[model samples]
Target chain A: MKILVVDDEQDVQVLFEQRFRKEIKAGEMQFVFAFSGENALAYLNQHEHEAVLILSDINMPGMSGLDLLEKIKKTYVKPPPIVMMITAYGDAENFNMAKNLGADDFLTKPLDFTLLKEKLKTIN
Target chain B: MNFDFLLIVFVARYLRTALKNTQQNSVWDDRLKLAMYVAIALFVASVIFRDAETIMAWVGHLCLLGCIYILYKETFFKPAKSLIVAILPYAVVATIIQFLQLVLPSFYRGNHSMVDSLKGFAVLWGIGVWMVTIKQKKELDKTNEKVVQQEHDNRIITAMKDELEVQVAERTAELTRQKEALETALQELQSTQAQLIQSEKMASLGELTAGIAHEIQNPLNFVNNFSEVSNELIGEMNEELSKGDIAEAMMIADDIRQNLEKINHHGKRADAIVKGMLQHSRSSNSIKEPTDINKLADEYFRLAYHGLRARDKSFNATLKTDYDETIGNIIIIPQDIGRVILNLITNAFYVVDEKRKFGIEGYEPTVFVSTKKRIDKVLISVEDNGNGIPQSIVDKIFQPFFTTKPSGQGTGLGLSMSYDIVTQGHGGTIKVETAVGKGTTFIISLPI
Candidate 1:
């Protein structure tokens, strides 16, 4: 499965990569990273129907995660990819909106990779 | 010039008389007046004793006459520029006077020689006056030099004092700026500490609430399930009763009725408290967006006061709101500001609650929340009518871990966190004004 994670913080990307390095190497998951919501949208526009999952952070400069989710839900045609929301504990309110916008699930940072793996396994 | 000399003599004599009458309290030196008196007296005597022919001869000797005029001019007329042209002339006039004293005896008769001798004596007296005036002029110049030196020293002292004043002012301004910065830093430190404490408190509350919720959820599930079962049983019993099986129907009805009572007993009790905890924990986590400040304040006011009421059944206070209708909307994190308002309102309620405990009959606690707009700034104010905050403790109210409440009752993080929200988090200001018995007002100013 191809998964794209969008976040403004570079350390968060590094953390995900470090946690999932073996999975990526084994070809169980192919990972793509975008540092901003706008970049994520542009990537989705270019590679439309390729990725199976998108994980986006809610707080970012320019376009936010909720906005990105809204745009994705509205614009994408065919079987749209599953999008999960990632937010801090203080921002738990957006989960309902994310679910309303057809998001797969919501996770808070610092993410529990073990839980993430279990959810991914089920998807697989 | 001669008229000026006469005026000087008359003025000096009058001044001397005035000084004597006043017991010489004047600052003017005595030698100057004395010299003026002597010069005037000698000048009058010389005029009266002059030989008409000899006076003509002296006039015919222009150099001698010029010398005498220069001496007179320097000594009695103008004292500044006259000296430059007067020195040589003075010496020449003195020699001519001496010569006239010697030669006039030969030109006159034997008896007239006595007059000539007297005239010589008068001439000698005139020379003596000139000598005396020259000496006085030297003394006057010395005195002037000393006055100039004193004036220079005074100028130096005045300049030094001016420089010192400027330095002191600069230092005072620098100290004031430093003091303000320190106050700001102290405020920021307090805010961060409060936030940390609040987060910790919420964390603990979240754990406790979740546990309570789970425990309540189980009992609620049982109530709901049993209620449905009892309702089914009632329907079945009614069917039996309709079919004329009366005993079986009555027995079933009793069982159903018993279950219904149990459901009513436990269900409502668990639900109310659980719902309250749920409301407390379910803080919205939406990101900052354009939100109406007035609405935000109202929401927090209700939640905070309601939460306090739940904690203490006796906590009752009147709340008044004065929101500026024109202060539209601002971009801010609604959740954060909501929490801030909740904290402030809660504190205000607490203050009023404490006051109500000790308040006199017919006195009720009151909390006022208000908002206003001024140019590009918005002001939000919270005030309370209670036993006013103590003077000594008012400044420490926003300090983290500072509270009048007993240990477990208050962590003292509310106002500190609110201060941060109004100041650093939003680039605004928070100030407090209070009187000992009149109550306290906290005003928050934020950029629009």
Candidate 2:
């Protein structure tokens, strides 16, 4: 399985790399990282059918995860990739917005990697 | 005739005494006395020698006429106005009486020689005329006295009126001066009061903003710390799994999972704080409660200073505080006021940190915070010895999006929001004074 993680914080790259290091090395899972929504969109354009699951932070300086999710749902229909919305806040408003924007799932940070792994197991 | 000469002498002596008793000052008076003496002396001499009657009689008549001229001068010439009316009437009567009696007497009194004393009617009429003359003279003297007194009275009244006018003019001038002074004083007082009110309002708003920022950071700090610690723990867990320590790896995994839960909980808390901040700002629903203003100020002052110090180790500055113990507690939105104090102190710290980095010789960075309790209000001041704002940019400091700081370092909303809060929320005032190289002081005032 391949996964794409989008966030603004540079430290998130180290955190995700460290968390999935064993999985990546054993060839059980592959990971790609994008620092922002714009970068994620740009990467998706090049590798449209590459990532099976996409995880994005909702609150960002520009082009929030919800907006990205909406764009993905509207543009990609055949073999549509699953997009998950993640945020620091688990507030009802954001959950509703993400659901309305056709997000595959809603998650709050700091992410429970165990639960995240369970959710990702059924993605394919 | 000898006895008549003695009587005439007695009459002269009586007349002399009466004239002397009047105590008048006049050459005319003396001449009248001399004429009286001449008339009496000649009458007496003519009687002593009966044969010389004709010459004596003519000389006496001349002396009497002299007396009349002298009397007229005394009556009419001395004062300016009184006897002019009397002079016409008196002169006409005296001349007609004299002409009728002395110049043409026999033609008028009915030609009766048998009543030879009927010509003596002239003598009777002469005596009556003399009495009338005396009465008239008295009246003239009375009129003269009244005229003199009226003239004196007019001068006194005129002087009194002049004095009153001068007094009135002086009083009016004094009143005008006092009115002008009072008006100026009132204007000065009004301006100062307006400034205090503006500062107090800004302070409250600033507190609101600072409270939001500080409150949000707390949960973020927890998440960041926990994440870092969990990463380290995960590393241990990975190593334990590699070593095939199954029980140890499980325990470490459980610990990591617990930390992750805590991170999630804290993240939600941060979200809640942000939402709450927005709600509070919108609803204006915070209740004004009693809080210790001095304690609030002192607390925020330290928090701002320490918060900056923790972020940048190389940044150093001295903090000074003066709190008015008398301002025990006051009614306010404590969280809101706290934010204001924090912003001022943080801004002060930022400037001082900048100055420390610049490495200027003989320059010491210091921030001072003070609170004062006026009779009707509270005053707070934050002072800093750093790079003070320039004069040209001072007026723009409180405008939204107007900042001297570089783009990334500030949102430029701090001072503008502070201005709104102090002025509109708390009915307060904010003031700033700065010199480019010296220092800056921000003053906030809130009415009790």
Candidate 3:
């Protein structure tokens, strides 16, 4: 399973890498990263239908996760990647918006990696 | 042949003088003229009717009485009230002539005609009374004219007083109306000023809120990311332990420690930002103390600059400060004056930031803050080398909600409220000097 994580904070990449290092080394789960919505879209453009799951932070400097989710849901029809939205505030407004924009899951920080792993395993 | 004729002549001459003195074109003039003619006729009848001289004497007496009455009418009845001399003689002569006519039949018949002699005496008496009445009438009319003139003057004075009172009342009413209008306008202005200040506060609060939101996220992100990754690393470390990979578990522990340090640092950074915001938002200016104006100005200048830079990473400007060390401390409401100084510095920073956005090659955005000690006042000036205000809008800059900044970028009450604080609140003066395309200087003077 290949996963794409999108966030404005660069530290999120190191954190995600360290968490899934064992899986990445075993070649059972692959992880890709993009710092912003634009970079995420650019990555998607080059590797269509490559990522099985997308995890995105809702708030960013430009092009929020909800906007990216809407764009992804609208543009990609054949075998669309399952997207999970993450937020810092855990607010209902962002949650409902992401859900309306066809996000498959919702997560709020500080994240429960155990639950996230369970969800990932179930989806797979 | 007798002395009575001499008296008669004297009365005729005096009658002529009275007529000449009172030559008025009225009923009194006609009456007085007829009396003069009657006096002459009485003298002629005395001569023609020597045998019926007694009847002529009576007629002469009655004619003289008529003349005196006319004089009374002309004198207007208020003066000449003490004319007993004329009335007493007429009554005595009339009574004596009637009694002698009844008692003595031979008194009328004499060789010299006793009736003619008596007639001469009556005519003389009539002339004397007429002369006396005329003299009294002249004196009385003079006094009457004076009284009439005095009454006339009094009426004029009363009318003028009434007119002046009315004018004063009208003026008072007009002034009251003007005062009421001014008071209403002042109240309206106060309410509008309050609303404008609130709006300006809310606008800046929104910007500060957004800045805080952006600032807190970076640290919070580190905290969130590290905690979650640390949890995963613990799981990985357990797995390594289960696999007997003690070295790998130790390495993961070291990475987690480094993440914790970053988390702690970012958390503290967010805490500092919140503390600064809380300090700024507190609205209290009641207490006053001696404050170092130079130190206060410098602190706000840096605070405003750093706050802007934190919110906008691309914003940059050169700052120059010249603070007077001799002007140590002045009594002031530090918070209120601090707000004014902060507002000025923020405006300076905004102007410089705007100029920088234009990307002019030779433009160097600069802001200068200075404090100077004068004889009786401490002067603080904020000078900026940004895009100076245009000449037309310069005069209205201190007006409430008057702003040249783009809509949603500024609420425009910064300088207006600052002016109010320095002037209305502290009895100080605020002045602005600006040149188009050159620079602007805002000076605030606080009296020692």
Clashing pairs in 1: B67-B89
Please write out the lDDT profile of model 2 over residues B1-448, one tens digit for every residue.
3322232343334445445535453554465466556656666677787786644544444444443344447543333222223233333343344455556678535543533454355445545655675687689879978998998998899999899999999999999999999999999988965655445445333444544554455458558856876887788788888999989889767767866886897798668655534533442565678888887776566445544533443455666789889898898876667666777887887887788687888676788999999999999999999889998999999987677779756666678767876888799999998989778999999999
Looking at model 1 chain B, report the run of 10 residues with the lowest lDDT sum: B75-84
Assess candidate 2 and give its lDDT.
Answer: 0.68
The candidate with the higher DockQ, 2 or 3, is: 3
Highest DockQ: give the candidate number: 3
Candidate 1 residue runs with Cα over 4 Å from true position:
A1-124, B1-62, B69-77, B80-116, B119-123, B186-190, B193-197, B235-244, B278-448
DockQ for the candidates, in order: 0.01, 0.03, 0.14
Q: Tens digits of per-residue lDDT for model 1 on B1-448? A: 1222343354355435534534333444375476466547644654665655455334334433443354456433334233324333334544455465667745445546565566556446545755675687679869988999999999999999999999999999999999999999999999986577657449435434433543354346546645655666677788888999999788777767766766775576466445544444554553557878887787556556544543443456677899999989988766666666666676777777777688578676788999999998988888987667888898899986687889877767767767776777788888888877667788888887
Q: Quick one: ranking by lDDT, best first?
A: 3, 2, 1
Model 3 chain B: ten consecutive residues of lowest lDDT: B1-10
Better of 2 and 3 by lDDT: 3
TM-score of each: 0.36, 0.38, 0.52
Chain A TM-scores of each predicted structure, in the order given, are 0.93, 0.94, 0.96
Give per-residue lDDT, candidate 3, residue B19: 46
